[model samples]
Target: MEQFYTDERNVQILIALLKEHGIKKVVASPGSTNVTFVGSIQQDSFFEIYSSVDERSAAYIACGLAAESGESVALSCTGATASRNYYPALTEAFYRKLPILAITSTQDESKIGHMIPQIIDRTVQPLDTVKCSVHLQTVKDAADAWDCNVKANKAILELTHGGNGPVHVNLTTTYSRNFMVKELKRERKIERVMTYGKFPDIPKGKIAVYIGSHVRMSKSLAESIDLFCETHNAIVAVDPTANYTGRYRVPYMLVAQQSIEDENRNPDLLIHIGEMSDMAGIVGQPKSVWRVNEDGKIVDRFQTLRYVFEMPEHLFFEHYSKSLLSRQNTYYNSCMEKCNYFWNNIPELPFSHIWVAFRLHNLLPMGSVLHLGILSPLRSWGYFPIPSHIEVYCNQGGFGIDGNMSSLLGASLVHPEKLYFGVVGDLSFFYDMNVLGNRHVGENVRILLINNALAAEFHLFKQTNLTKVNEIERFLSAGGHFGCKSLDVVKHLVEDWGYEYLTASTKEDFEKVYERFITPDLTEKPMIFEVFTDVNDENEALRRMYFIESSTRYKVKNAVKNIIGEDRMEIIKKIIKR
Candidate 1:
């Protein structure tokens, strides 16, 4: 009779689990400790095994195979320093998110301190090298067999779970020489599904969808989302970059401004979609966040991620929306009411970046596109509503000041006929000043450069901690990095590049030249409207805006303080106390 493979129970259980999960490709490196595993699987015609003498080359081969085949590949190696050779390739797989499984066979770990020649403790790999690590116990009895089977399944499943990466399974074997087992032992198989196979039941409670920076959605997807919001009594909150023009788009600025006290506006189930968003500063605290993405990774942006629905956004929203009863629009109405109230009660002030945004909010031509810089410019314009036809774009992806002008220039190239306006702070403007010299800049591109002489964000009230640091002027705020602070430096540069340079220092100067800058009539050259404002007025304008968004009591107190002046109000308070 023909001799069969080894009857080692742990090896049999692991092989059975691997086959059950449809893992058919096994890359085996020559070794003694893994002889039983290799020899057994080699006999099983179900697996197509490839032999490699070098463990390092074997790992790269498996990575290539998994990448091309779009299937998980398993690499098996013997004990000693053989598994260490997999470090370089495994590190590449980990970073690339390739699903490679490294199965290292060894003698009992207890033999490590005994100076056993061929044993190395691979209890753990380097940090983030693998998604997870599992140590398989020797299968001696039914309990041990079941534990081994479960662990093997878990290790394999983890290879493609959450975010795909490599996983390690260190199997302990006794080197049994019995090679007469004809049939492998039957074992239970565990399967994990990251994507939704069917529509899950919608959670009962207030549901809200928060969309981050995303490209424009198709009309059908927008309509479906709108229907979902209508049917489920849900609202879709978005920052300006969300690019969604759906009816359910809530006034996020008002919601963000009132986030401190709006308990009802907070969603019990917050479904987050899209990429990163800067609206975390504005949205109310959520009780739970359910992230929907194809990657299925657990992204806890709100510190309340309970479920990760790994699927396309439209499918998840459409399915979940169908299973809900309609909810009241009270939350939506309250948000709009507060937004209207703030817009009406905003205080007019001295010339500043925000003051320009307030004045030009209604004046921006219909159907024009607005591109804003990352920090101060984006935040300032977000307070006012833009025409629905007007699309807004910003560089919040890397959130750096380096590419603001370059990105706006690229967009202008695509739509040369459409008017494009970019609002940028002086730091961002100067960082990408070379783009201004580009020959492709057309007459349709207009820029609003807010030159406050320094990085005003470092001087905001909330950033008081940064301001307290020593040498903040040079290091933190980037003061005096460029030459002397004046528009003369900018004027000389832009005039040589064929730009219509316009300067505004006071409101009178701004009103005189602002109309010509915003006019739809195309200019012979691209224009640069540089508005110079004092740092103190910019800080005070921001503080007063926050006070306006505060509670009714604060609004009343601010009004009284403005009417009576600060010194007289303090004196009256002291007199009342006496």
Candidate 2:
């Protein structure tokens, strides 16, 4: 008997669903089983595919891209060993709340217990780490496979649409290429629009817009919020990549919250966006507060007097601006006025790192993507204003430099046509230097290394005590061959490694070098810009920064404490006091 329906449509259904969801990026590893689905995806020009030779990097690259974009990104690999390769990234993504969709090939269900070559507990291997795992059986079992696909897609959307996190989808080969295209098309639901409820009355004056570590929200939202702030004369302090300061145009950020208290400015309202963990300790308690969260969950880190877990900030501001009345206050303006004075009186140092970031922000191509490493480079980006449209990514959720080059390479793979920049420290670049060899990465990606010639962060410790210099020098031995930093070695990297290198010794040199690097010949492959600085001067700047932020010194101390974690608080206490 000839069957009227076929299972071949399932893959189309799932891929079509992904396309409908605006998931334009996919990271894939070479595998035999996923050939059909990959072929289909390739045929469709809607989604871009980044092929990674290493499955582990493939998964983390997907994690990094989605984390940066605040959306769901997919990674595909074969079953068994290939699936196992994604575990580390899966755990990290789960904990960090990055939305990573993964697909793995599988053996037929009939061979489940027959000791098949690539068979393991596929359904349960990452059960503990993933939000949900669906065993997509077969296209003939449309009731089962499509359900899993829809559920997996929904989980990703829910994870990211809320606070931006990761989720896993375990797709089996038997179901990958099968779907009842007609039926699935009738039920497809894509693109969810977030809406927010009304926030409480704003204080007539003294409102502060404090931006935390965040990505997402439309440009229209920023403009509306700016208008509201302008109308109310609110003090807007933005964290890195918030695009908050650009609209305000004043030095609208404080390096430390102690600065706010030092200036004797307390606020009636503390409207916060994104993660508050970093700023929670400093902002202290607010008299009244409101938070806009995508997931509708309330987090009272400061135990503020009031709470509102509205939808995305953009939706909230859009609604508020239409109905809410503006209230101007003197205290808010006074607080901002002092912030203005601080900016005007910024100490004339030899050269500040923020100046470097400010210059790069302009030099980088407009509408480009920047993958900023989590250490000094990320901190500098906080003070510098970025173009509102230029997408920025960092490993701030669980900051690490171990995979700096690989992660950016993966991101570049997904969007090969767009200009991509990897902003990393010398230490970070050395850690993952091999990623530079990934043939998948080409002219689209650039490596911008801020080479201060030593561990920039450790330089701060050298200032605390001259004895720490010896300790700092020890790190140099373990991180890279000393030859890598020698002038000869750097030249070898440019001439032999096939990377176009540019070095900067002075502030003026850096500005000119950066301008040229930013305006690259897009027709050619990506280039690397290695900006060199003096190790001694870098340390001096950090020491001065610490002194300027002594009241908030506990922030750095807490980071050190986290090394031992809560279990060894007693040990951390002794070290802090020492």
Candidate 3:
């Protein structure tokens, strides 16, 4: 006999997570909007469900069950006055701290204020009614699905968080009649842990710690992470902004996606720390991701989140370092071997941002501070290595292009004796160029503005890949702005502002001025090298660095994708996977 579930993505995710969390007892009230959720669970024998004609009675019954069993009990109700009836019992559960989950199904949220029949505004709930609330909309894309997963996990986790109380999950349904979908897709379950709480034992497999853009690294935190990586046979994938000086730190984000097929690339257990970097899906597809943040919120960036350790990152690493579970560095060695291979095999690229970083990264003065602007510069410099003593910063915590120059100026103020470098694109440099006039600006500032005359990031990579290259410049890249790379625009300003400006239009020009820009000594005036290049050359450099020309399989897959479209290609891939 075949089992079926609702085709609605959000509903399916809810059902899957409920099963994963083992909240099998359900009290369901009869209604149309909630039919998909109730019907799907009713068919699954794993759920022991009770029915009630009154929505108010259904919620009280769930509260009673949860109180008696000392476990979570789920309640479901449809739209209109039916969901309003659950407030009294939810209030009681909230005060008494009973573990109950109230799932109220509703029509599209857009219909709420239009005076449409059966649509009510459930967004504002009484503060005491539940401990937490998360409204789940229909899942549309990977990001939306990630939201649904995190919210569903959050709602479920609230049942046991702090004390225990009822939580609301306002689910918007599409009323889809399709129930032919077989087997629920596996969902990510998040287990939250705190200090003095039970911790998960180390699993035997390839493990890696991925740290994102951290502003500064304390000495103790660095040592704890180093010992953990060494003890657990693991590696640390990082960006320049990660600021982790451990021996195992691999700033391989530029080449991370290319290692999808390598087993070592997809760590079995990946621990993530700090805030996000601009590189989306840079860690490849991992088996599971465990996040350690003091805030303890579920941020399922990779969509594979399984644990959220609510403590300092160093504590999480130190806790696991005492595992005493014997391990070897085989995983670390294997990944580093492939990482080095990828670096050496990178094809010769055109004179572009990546080329500039490759030529200048290692040559930077030691113990200096380096700042990279948004996406392209980070991707370029992240591929190369700087000295361990050089600290790195990027505006990626906000992931904006507004304050690259200002931030560099601020950092250089305190460390006037040490050199500071700002590597930014033209748009970002001009956007925050006002910082150059500040009286506190120091002579240690070395700015390298890569002026392609537009937002070169928007013109390359997976961004609107099907859009024509020429058309991209018109709108997406916002080309023909920013003085159109006028040689004198920046030069005139720098000279008037009492700073040295060097302009370069070709590789030879950059080579000729390289020595002056990277010289270790502090100069009388701050210096800037505004290197100009063509957007076509930037795209070429990215294509070569990503190894697009060498991947015949990727070429064929993309060709098929362009012909059949992404949706159909996804279906074909799913069929092949099956």
Q: Which predicted model would earn the best TM-score?
A: 3
Return the candidate ranking by TM-score, descending. 3, 1, 2
Name the lDDT value of residue 7 in candidate 1: 80
Cα error, candidate 1, residue 447 (Å): 0.7
Model 3 per-residue lDDT tens digits across residues 258-355: 62355556778889897977754556778888999998888887778888999988889898888545656776677677667677677777889988
Each model's lDDT: 0.82, 0.63, 0.85
Q: For model 1, state the Cα shift of residue 492 in Å.
A: 2.2
Where's the lowest-lDDT run of ten residues in candidate 1?
191-200
After superposition on all C-alphas, the RMSD of every candidate to the true structure, in Å, is 13.0, 18.7, 5.8
lDDT of 1 by residue, 341-377 (tens): 7788787766888899999977888788899998888
Report the alpha-carbon TM-score of model 2 versus the true structure. Answer: 0.53
The true-versus-predicted C-alpha distance at residue 158 of model 1, in Å, is 4.6
Candidate 3 lDDT score at position 430: 84
Model 2 local distance difference test score: 0.63
Candidate 3: regions farther than 4 A off: 1-12, 24-30, 38-69, 88-96, 138-147, 174-187, 257-261, 280-282, 323-328, 345-349, 461-471, 548-578
